[model samples]
Target: MLDALAARAAGPGRITVFEPSPHLWRGRPYGPDLESVLVNAPPAIMSIRHGDLGHYAAWLGGRAAEHLDPLLGEPLVPRALYGEYLEHTAETALAALREAGWEVRVVRSRVTGATGAGTRMVLGTEDGQRHEADHVVLCVGGGTPPDLYGLDGAPGFAGDPYPLRRTLDRIPSGSDVGVIGSGLTAVDVVVSLAARGHTGRISLLSRSGMLPHVWQRPVERQPRFVTTDRVAALHRERGTVALDDLVGLLRDEIDSAGEDFAAFTAELLAAETDDPVRRLRAQLDAVDDHRIGRRFLQLTAHTVGPYAWRLLPAADRARLRRRLRTATGVASPMVPVNASILMRLFDSGQLDAVAGVRAIEAVNGRFHISGDQGRRTTAVLVNAVNPAPQSIPRGAAQLVDALAADGTAALHPDGGLASTDPRLHVIGDLAAGGSFITSSIPAVAFQSARAAAAVTAASDSGRALSG
Candidate 1:
């Protein structure tokens, strides 16, 4: 979106981006030294620009082709290299903005709040400086997670297990590491430890004991019976569809697929494959023709998720929250290589998946966990959970909280912060509930274009009025 902002703002006032880190545009996911961590999506699907799905690949082809790894005939590049790619893209955008005589400034302080009326906005910084801008874009992805389990400040309790390559290093060699969560973040933690040749038993603790499904590069699919257009039509006819209605629709689609859908789901959840990664990839290959159909349905869900989510009665939304892990497990699967690394660890008796994580307590100079399998002691407890939709506070940051406090910012009933004043635009993960999937690169790019267009139009209108 920053890229789009840079490209579209031709009649601009100064463009200032507040990034407290040296890693501009790269953000948290693409931070430095995370070379071993693999991206969940293939290079084919990860482009910061719309209609140019191969943008990242093309960039890599020119500079870092060697970083590409061929798995299942798709390129899975290192996360750090992707970070470098983003930095380069940002540099290009900045250069273009400068060439067009627009001042582009990167603020190196933490932005806490943005408050003002109409076009005049005051952005508050942590250092007591109130920087002003004509427009403010809240690209604050995910705010830092509070210690959900009250394990903060405890010995060997590592909060924010990000830049995993570095954080996991603090664990002693051969120490047992208990990671709370089964998503990509947890996978990265285990993969990072394994890649660093750390000899330790890594336990993945989750509610369902279900790992993210292994991903295959999607084949072209057509939505035969289930399409977004149809879902939108249903929404029009009913004015709103309940959660049960949507589920029934999905069940019908799966039923229409007959044996193929049944087999795929069966294989996906079955414990038959000791090597879960290989089994999943093989299952996907077996259903190659039908794989895209499932993907198309998933895409439809992404399209309908926001509407369905918002239309859902409060009770149904609660149900959705309860089933979120299952929804996430199927909807956002991991790439094969990361799963393969996990499978290898599992096979080596170095990793185990534990269920029923009921509690965590500091005990005897170590961390003790009581869960589905009873109690276990570990030398390190790492929180690898990603911040979910409900995690963002009204005042997630100082600026956001202040906006909420003064009634300048309104919380979207679904998710995200909206400024009562038009100049403030919030997007990304923070804009959850506004869209079903805002975390992916493609989703972010799509959103960035829309937001950029609106901001640019406003800038042009301002210029015209002044002229």
Candidate 2:
């Protein structure tokens, strides 16, 4: 959506998209059962366009008594309200596009397969139909789900959590339910179930029993930061920077406006991939913090700046990769889950958080979670674990096989699930770009923008480009 929007806004090629869950635009990872899932990221930071940061707030202002909206005091508003806010912003964007001469095509079909030959790409839809795109962008950023295999009576185990929102609609008023994760989704399930007045005993199961950390609102400033200096010192001294110290220093830098907090953070993230020594230190530290290790996985993303995650020197990257062995690591980017939701579940006593299910054998009527916490069962078992190429419909696997067979693309290992052709970009839970974190708007926005650019650049037949 961001790609098509940017393309149209840039007066580039006609923008067309194939979104599987077409109506899912209102807010994703959405549910008919969820009534209390609030946007954890403050609405202020959640806008698609940086220029429209407080646009939703202004609308709420108009609706406020004396226009003093309570939401202002607390930026995290209910998902439903945010849904409306998203609709309004999207409508405004769509209207603007229509007013322009660009023809935007949005097809509501799952892209089961895609391949490129020369300048044209062939894409297969869920309905067995194929379409052509000058360039194709796979919005596959939303990570796939788990495959429930060796667990007891597991073949009968149903592996759907997100789509099962409707299953929850008819759930008993107060039933005991077992959640399989302590991450954000688990949290979301608890909160949503709570909103429905279902006071059930919910247990969250995970291997490490780690819950996500909460996102505290921005606090008043403290001191200055030195990025290159810190990076230089870390490289020179080969040591760790305390989290608090780093945060304080970075905050000071952002306050000085010598750098964009966003850009600086982006750089730090980029550096994690570029500077080998730094990336190794990060991975080593992260391995030790298994409780909330994923947070560290992200803090060191591939950086465009000197501070982010990037490839270490061959030696250091190799060392880092070795240290990362025990960690539940990703070769490519994966969706970041919600942590606040998990904490909410724990608070409600709805989550019985446990880890490791040896097998999922069945009992008299339902399934048993036979493993770490002994045998207990639930009426249903939904696989909420993050999906990889191994999990989803064979469509992706088959598509990837075809890509390799045709010699049109090469897999980038850490799942580069389907990025064989730059002209054919992939996003959402599928890209496997070493950074799959969430199916959130922010994640998608970043992915879509990149996809749009690649597609646009690939489609350039006679256009002058501007940077």
Candidate 3:
């Protein structure tokens, strides 16, 4: 939001930011963590500056090569290092806003409640202070990872395994570890453990045991058929976008690239039910695949995803929801570097992934897990389950509840704040009426731009009315 305002020179007003974390720009995911915890996406997609794809890469300059992950063929830098880029971008935006006659104040406090105050909105903070604003943009990050196993106070169990720096050390290097969930977060725990020279067996337990596909070396080809403009044109003509219509566009894109769409999608679906080790090995080998299917899906999943999602009929939306796990795995793939790490661990007989996790009990000083593969006990357990997209965080629950109770704001049936109220804006994962998938950085950047424009335009209109 600050970046958009600064870019537009929309100032001459005061802007107050409420942030309780010590790390200003880096939220929970990017805060100080082990170097092994990398930014999941490449620089091409991680930019916060909307429309400027190279913004992050430009900031990296010569430092890019130093943090390159060779297997991914892109600079998959550490999350902490990426946090530095966020901090730099934020400071630059603040400076520009100040120079443009904007008074920016940073309050190191968490907002607890929000209510309507005439034309303005009142925000109550945890510090027992209230402030009024013409518009409020809720940027409270994503929801907390749920304790699926009810292991909050259990010994040797990490309910939330973020900033692995704190959680990893407490785990004894020699203790056998069991990680819940086979997604990116679980991969982070495994890789960070290896980096810390931990010499214990590690097992990933999940319902599907499906791991994220490895990202292929990016190509220069742009989508010819699945572009947002094409989607908009379709919606104008048909009034709704069906699942078959989307598949048709994808088919055209793949065929135009001279690849067999049927074969590509077949392999993709098969990977979901394929053996873990074999699938990971195949993905590692296909890092340089020339096929355009995955790349096309990746590009459009964010850009055309939300827009198409809104226009999709209820039946089509339900169809997509049925395969949510597959969609998530394909859309958010792991870096080749981590895929290789998992393979090595598998080869060395130190790592394994099991599906059908039915029960997890904290036994006497150990974790006993029962799943499709029967039972296994580990000395330590880590919950790496990805949080549901746009679910409200525990800390901000009070504020959101207050708004919903007062009819000041409401949540979408799909999760996230509804767009019914103009006085209250939302960005990041909390924003409603977006793709069911969690908001990516690029998606968040787009939301921020829209929110900034709305706020500034309203301010301009108010001033004009007074004149």
Candidate 4:
């Protein structure tokens, strides 16, 4: 967002950012962490600058080789390394803004309340300071992972597994560790533990023991049938795009590339019921898949996903929600390096994942887990289940509530905040009425561009009226 504003704003204006964290540009996910924790997406899709496919890669010029993952055929850098990119990008943006006659200030405080003050908005911070702004954009990021088992203060329980450097050392090297989700965060915990030379047995407990699919070597193919323009055209013609309409577009995309749609859909469905080890093995073997279905879906997810989501009828949305687990697994695959680590652990009988987790209890200084696979105990338990999309962070909850209570903003029926005032905007994952998978960097960049344009246009309008 700062990048967008720097490039487009016709400003000799002031911009103040209230950030309480010492790691300014590097949020929780990209903060200092074990080298094993990697940026999940490819460089092409991870750019902070909107519409610039090679932005991140251009910055990684000479050091790309050091972070390259051979299996995925991409430089999956450490989270800390990526944080450096963010910091550099932010500094560059700030420099550009200063050159453009804009004064930018960063405040080390958290916002606690927001209320409308005549034509402006007044923001109150935790440190008992209030600042007024003509426009406000909430970039609070996502919420912390919830503790599902009521083990917040348990001796051996880790409520959040982030910055694993802080949590991993406390656990005995040979003690059993249990992770509570089968998503990317869980993958991080497992891979980081192995990287630290921890020989403990590890188990991933979930309602559906479905791990993310393995990412294939990316191909240089753009979608012809599944583009955003085509989706908009469909909505114009039919008023709404149904689930079957999307499937038809996908089929056309795959068939045009000379792949069998039936075979592809069947394989995707089979993955949900297939054994986790065998499924992962199959995915690993097929990393060089010649089929275009997966690639098409990956490209369409962020590019066309938001538009299609808005046009989808309630029934179609509900149907997609029913299969969200499978859809998310396919859309957000893990990089091959982590998949290989998991494979090695599975081969050594030191790691396993089980579904239908019924209950978890803290007992006798250990964690006991009961599920479909029956009872098991572990020396340490880590919560890896991410919060739902657009969940308000605990720190920002009071501010969001205040805005809603006073009608400055309204809570979306779906998640996130909806602005009632033109001066206020929402971006990133907190923007309401976005796709379920709207938290990606590409999506955030898209939203940032829109918000920046809106803010600048409004500023220009105000100036012209005064003149």
Report lDDT (CA) for all predictions: 0.69, 0.49, 0.86, 0.86
Which lDDT tens digits does candidate 4 get at residues 1-467? Answer: 88888789775777888889879988889999888999998899889999898999999998889988898788999989999999999999989978977778898998888887587788888899988888888888887898888999999898988889998988899999999999999999999999999987999999999999999998878788888888888989988888798899999999999899999999899877999999999989989987889877877887788778888998888888788788888888999999999999999999998899999999999888898889989889989998877678887899999999979999998888889987788877777877677478888898889988888887553221000
Quote the positional error of residue 397 for candidate 2 in Å.
4.8
Query: Residue 194's C-alpha lDDT in candidate 3?
Result: 95
Provide backbone clash counts, one per model.
Answer: 4, 64, 0, 0
C-alpha lDDT (0 to 100) for residue 75 of candidate 1:
69
**Which digits, one per residue and each the tens of the lDDT, describe model 3 over residues 1-467?**
77777787555777888888899988889999988999999998999999999999999999889978887778989999999999999999989978977778898998888777587778889999988787888888896789988999999999999889999989989889999999999999999999999999999999998999889899998988997888889989988778899999999999898888889989888976899899899989999878889978987898888778888888888888878778888889999999998999999999999899999999899999997899999989999998888788887898889888878788888887775567778787787766668788888899888877777777543211000
Off by over 4 Å in 2: 1-4, 7-12, 22-28, 31-33, 50-73, 84-91, 126-128, 149-158, 163-165, 220-307, 313-351, 379-382, 388-404, 418-420, 436-443, 454-467
Clashes of 3: 0
TM-score of 2: 0.67
lDDT-better candidate, 1 vs 2: 1
Residue 333 lDDT, candidate 3, scale 0-100: 93
lDDT value, candidate 4, whole model: 0.86
Model 1 residue 94 CA deviation (Å) reads 1.6
Q: Is candidate 2 or candidate 3 better by lDDT?
A: 3
Clashing pairs in 1: 112-398, 112-399, 113-399, 395-401
Q: CA lDDT of 453 in candidate 1?
A: 84
Candidate 1 local distance difference test against the native:
0.69
**What's the TM-score of each model vs. the native?**
0.87, 0.67, 0.97, 0.97
